[model samples]
Target: MNRYTFSTQSGKAYYCNSIPGFIADQSTDIVGRLVRHAFDINKEQANAWENQITELQRRLEECGMEGDIIFEYDIVRLGKRIDVILLIRHMVFSLEFKNGKDIFTTQDAQQAEDYAIDIKNFHKESEDLYVCPILIATDAARYPNPQSCDCYPDKQVHLQRENIETLIPKITKISSLYGDDGEIDFDKWFNSPYYPTPTIIAAAVEAYSSHSLSQIAQSEAGQENINLCEAKIYEIIEYAKIQKKKCICFITGVPGAGKTLVGLDVVAKSLDDANGLSVYLSGNGPLVEVLREALKKSVESNDREREDLWKRAKKSAGKTFDVPKPEKLFNKHTQAAINTLIQSSYAFKKDNASHSNPTPENILIFDEAQRVWNQEKMARKHDDPIMAVSEPKLLFSIMDRHQDWAVMICLVGLGQDIYDGEVGINEWFRCGIEEFKEWELFYSPLIFSQVEDKNIDQEKILSCERCHQIDELHLKTSIRSFRADKQCQFIDALLDNDPKQASEVYQQIASKYPIYITRDYSLAKKWVRAHVRGSQRSGVLACSSAQRLKPEGIYVPTEIDVKNWFLAPSDDLRSSNMLEVVASEFKVQGLEIDWAIVCWDADLRRSKNGADWDHYSFRGTKWNKRNKPEQKRYLVNSYRVLLTRARQGMVLFVPKGVDPEEDPTRDTEYYDGIYKYLVSCGIQEL
Candidate 1:
């Protein structure tokens, strides 16, 4: 059977006589499997399909068209199949059929547009073509003319029609205005390259379930490292299972090196084993929230009606489908559930008593393990109910309660600990050596050197009874910024006060991943807005301590809801795509955007010596310098997080300090020094 049930080349008649054959052929194609599955889950869809075919057959008989037609055409990598695709001269039409409907719903229109957008973004051959998505509600009144809107002009068109009487006329008019310069190669368009972009959540889910990383998109440069990381992780899991030993391994990587991906992948693939289940935990609240939501959305989108349908089908099979109670469905083995396998560290710690071990799950994967709280932070908070020495110590104590064997995987990112409570990587080593010596330890030899943790005594760690350093555990490349592999190196050098080296590294990657620096906030914003294309994400980010930035219309704290800001559509002002709101390091540390505007404030500035950092906090009408060493480190790391959050490029908006005399809090000296230091690093000024 053909991949598509029906397909014809451009400049050919799509005859109504072939509809029956197409339907018969589709019964054996991919769409057949989808339809059978839909019948078991959503019977309405199965009924709709029959009527849809009849309507399309009737419509084609009425509308005389000169184009290629494809029925049940699978879109690129989205796991979605478009109803029909009409390839005409210089234009492609995406048609959605609501066969039994009398009214065109908003959701129908959005789905049609989303299909067109997916095709345009993922289909390499369709990028230059004018793709118009039409929604046909067969029973609805016919709209004789297509509406004109400037929203996605030239690239997108929307049509709501009752029949195909006016469809040909509209297509002719659209072709006359925006048709391609020449005829397209039908064979090439049919086999165009598809670019798949699975979110970190989806990638993890697929990798875990499939026992392979083939589905996750990777750049040619980082594919080897990504594969190596996945292989090493799998080996560790198998070793723990075979050895029947309690082990803890640290997987360290540069910023955006897929550290979280490695953790999630391990958890996903490990959950199905009879030996033990795995749970993924993250100390980063925003990371956890966004990832959990994304995972929930992924599960919901794929099997929205699976549960109800399964219940109905099971009744006929003489099986019981227990109706869920009022409580939340967070049970093990319920793969369709939400946040069952993935959880937040704070929530997990809070729910489980310090001395209690809830599950026998042999493995616990910790993403951003370095962000775990220190002994001081946990103890200092008086009003908080839960008491723990440190997150690592607490984690070890709970896992120690395991009956036989267990493993804890810590996914670490270098220089990404951006909060005060964060104790860095040393806390885990200290906890393991000083307290949980019975648990076996395995980590990359580069962990100590990468974090530069002055608090760690390497000799004591090396002398630990069960400590083992594995070279395969360290990930060196930055997969996040595919445009420049060495972008993290430049950021590290700049943050480490090596301006000369930073400048040299910047020049090498400047052409590919542009980094713009400007004192004018508006110019920096404009630069970011102009650079981002298609649905490429762009946003403004600042350090959490950027209280003085409110004057520039960027209030980082209460103004932005990180979840909505990150996930909302471009039309929603709350979305990051609007560039109206700014996310702080706390909200955007692990995630990335296509382009970003790093709003530099007086929160962290270059010291007089021009080598070290001086941290400041805005208090009322004055700027107070924070003299604590730990605070200084966090303040510096905050900038590192913000700077590295951009996948493609970034622009720095350093305000010139509106007449420093009028507002002493906005001193020009504080802003100028950092701007000059960044300029010295070979970052271009707009």
Candidate 2:
């Protein structure tokens, strides 16, 4: 089968003499070919493809262009396809045609630009090539002076169908600007490797709706690592099932390393198992809420399509069928089912703590397991002393109820514990070693490498007979920031007070992944707004302890509806795009935005001598130092979450403090040292 619906640059189609013949080919043949590649081709889609082909052929022939015209180019990450890709010389044109439309809309323009950006960022061969995104509204009035050649820094030009015939000459003149005059290799470009790092929300929705992550997981290296992790966990699950033994597996990775993706994939694949069920649990409330909401919307959409098909089938039978009252697919029962599949760890604990019976699910995947509460925190939250055990211990006891077989997979993130009483990975191992000795234990070798603090008893855990180290369980690279894999490393160095190393790493990724600093909050907002485009999300983020930022129009105390904040339309006031509401590290820990404005406050500021960070908390009107080790770690981790939340880029907004005499709490010394330190780390000032 062909990779695309049709191609004009392969085999006999490559010759310029055969171009006219190919253009004049029947639309039915092309439609039929596209139908074979698609799952369900509607009449509207078929007509659009036919019209796109006819319009494209006329434009190509009029321009006398001799290059490849790929119809229906697949963009696997988005689960959508570009209408056409015109590869002429060193230029790559991404075309999105709006059939029968007389006016261009913002949605269509953004869609066109998104395709170009995706190709430029993810497609290996198109990285350096000039990509022009054109939105052609077939019936729209032609622009008197179309800016077809006005290219952005990323080499993307948005244009209309008007004056498209003149595009070839303009493209030819700019080909020299790309530093390559040679013709593009059509085959190589068409078959180029595409590494798309989808947002976690996108991955979860795809996994739940399609029950397959093939389209979402596209990177060769990153996807292979995730797949291996999934496979190894499944192997352990199967062994436990066959041997009638309980087992637990720990999978660790750096921040944004697709650890959550592995857990979601395991749950998705396990749906096929009729013998048992799998559940994905997370302590992060916002992450669970967003995923469930996205998946619920997907379910409702699919149901609506099915209902439409049902109505059409009844009409075809020539029988007048009374339309039944619309039954909502995303009703209470459906929500209950969704909750069972992807649940909050706290809720899961509460539901099972009251019962001694075994759960129907034999496999449980814990996401962000490092954030599980320690015994002290758990005790204070629960009224009953019997339920006061640490989260891991309680979770293990629940799973241990299954006498025959059960499996538990913990997805651990390093340096992500941003809240009090959230014990790191040590709690899980401690529980496994001291309490659940009968259950077999498997962990990533990378866990030991990252344990800098001697809190975990590695020797005792490894010496156990049931404990085994598996190399495949650890993910090495960061998939979230496809533009910069070393972003986490840079953040580490910056926080570790190693400005030289941080500056060196920043230099390497400065061009592709922008990191800027600004003293003015408005300027930081403006910078993020300018960089965001095409449905990309940008938001203001502050640490929860940043109480002083309330004076700067950033109120961390404001409770944001995360589902709306992350998923609402840009025009909606509730949307993060509005930048009215600020999300704290607590709300956005496991989530991400395309661009971010990180508001810095006196809560975690550089020390007087700039030797280390000093942690502080706001009490009444004055700031008090937090000397506790746990308190200090949480303060640092809060910034870590905020710093790493941006997938594309971020702007650190360090407010200029007021005069000490006017307000001692807002002293300039509190912020100046940190701002200077950030500059020394190679963060460009806005």
Candidate 3:
């Protein structure tokens, strides 16, 4: 049959379980593998490449070409060959094929001429014939590295396939670039694997938005909030509009930047508009409980309206919409279960990636991105469970694909965080970690591709002492935060091991907002109870660590029972999984008080020999997931839930060591940097 057989001469192998019929059979040496190393890649890429081949055929036909479009084809038999064949206006015939490796030589020319003879003999065409051959090498650089698929001294065309796209534009630019290559062979292409003419292809894509983000056309939030705290909500809106990108702006902020408020604003905007889908994608346990209650209120507010729905639906289909009974939809237990399932071992990765139709008008906003949406690398074995082992650089690649279906992508979390080193910097900035790495397109699954920008300033972005303010145009002028925010700011700046950055946090607070050093929990409680009294939602999360809280405790709350509380995990992976049980218990009582009194419990003495236990152990070779042994590490992930909860504001319920009475402010300048910044901004003095 002389079927065109192709195989990787040498490369690494991969395994895929995407196809049921192609499932790997058990019992071989190195049994489970997929794509085995690309080239014939997958159904997706093969068609993508073939489409380019047909485009070239279309070009030939437009200039008056003809003949059999494709040879008798069978993928399993013929492999990746005979991309297309065309008969030109003047007794001229052509054959087109794409090679990952550039093959633009006499040998390649002979192969095409031979294909020409075969076509002629089989079809019994006219005797007068001229054969034209075109060899397309997609990645021109890799194929002939540094040598192009164009300007071949002896032969024709090397339409650049850098994007696997650009094939069309290149198709249009061909006649001019290659002088006398003739016309677009539309007839041949219409009959090739990449069916439908270029016009049809363009129309179809016009249906799907382009996947690109340009700085001049990107979201402005990063530039606006370059100076202050707060969600920089307005900027987010602008960015979404300009790029037309459905995205999740991953945000990592302290207690007061108003990430949630911004999220709410986004949700409200989504609901009111018809073009975008704006959803608060966080279905966390506690949060879902709150959402259910709110949903119930909505149902209560619209009981009569729903009855009308029942009447209308009954009239039409002889049935009711059933509306799922708002109560069932808003059941705390049910919502909690849904939240748990969404973040379960099964749903996290793929669900996050998939933004479904009947998709929201804009984006599905997700906060606490780091905690829940981990970029995990699943080390799956056929015998192993389906979950990925979760490496740090996991989803670093497909973040764009995840954002494409939406209008904007928002991620909020600390960057230098997850210090335990299970991930990579998903955000790229050439200068350092803090700045945003501007990207236009992420072409491959390898994640990022930097288009050469003549103006990427590696120079540091100028900023004031707060390290938050900058030259961004959209500065927020709202003081929606509070007093202890000063203390929190102090801890973040001056309490560092190396005494520097800021000298007086008091001054820092003054420049931004008023700083009140209060040592009364009752008074703090009074303020919280007064403000968040009924729907009064606020907390004074404690830092039992004496590590993060000690400084604030000195001037904040003096009498705290720092012993039997949570010390809070510095970085925890199992938070969402365990907190549900704990939250359900205390949340029922005042233990789940409207205001939380948090502190890093001084009791986590790192496991010596445990008590309430049985889990797994990966001791070198064998699997021992049965009991707590000396080699693993685990902590109550609830520490995050504690710090994150205040729907309003929080207090400094910290330990003494984490802060100080005499002031690391050292008589005056300890937080000088912060105070100076606040002073310049005209914030009241601490």
How many backbone clashes are present in model 3? 88
What is the per-residue lDDT of model 2 for residues 457-538, given as tens digits with 9 covering 90 to 100? 7888878888899999898888878778889999999988899999999999888789999998888888888777677899
Per-residue alpha-carbon lDDT of model 3 for 256-370, expressed as tens digits? 3344444444454444456554444442433433433333443343555455444544454445333443232335664453343123222343454344223323454554443
TM-score of each: 0.75, 0.90, 0.34
Best by lDDT: 2
Steric clash pairs (candidate 2) = none
Count clashing residue pairs in model 1: 2
Q: Which ranking of candidates, highest lDDT first? A: 2, 1, 3
Report lDDT per candidate. 0.71, 0.80, 0.32
Best by TM-score: 2
For residues 135-162, what per-residue lDDT tens digits would candidate 1 score against the true structure? 7776777764557622243265544343
Better of 2 and 3 by TM-score: 2
User: Model 2: what TM-score?
Assistant: 0.90
Clashes of 2: 0
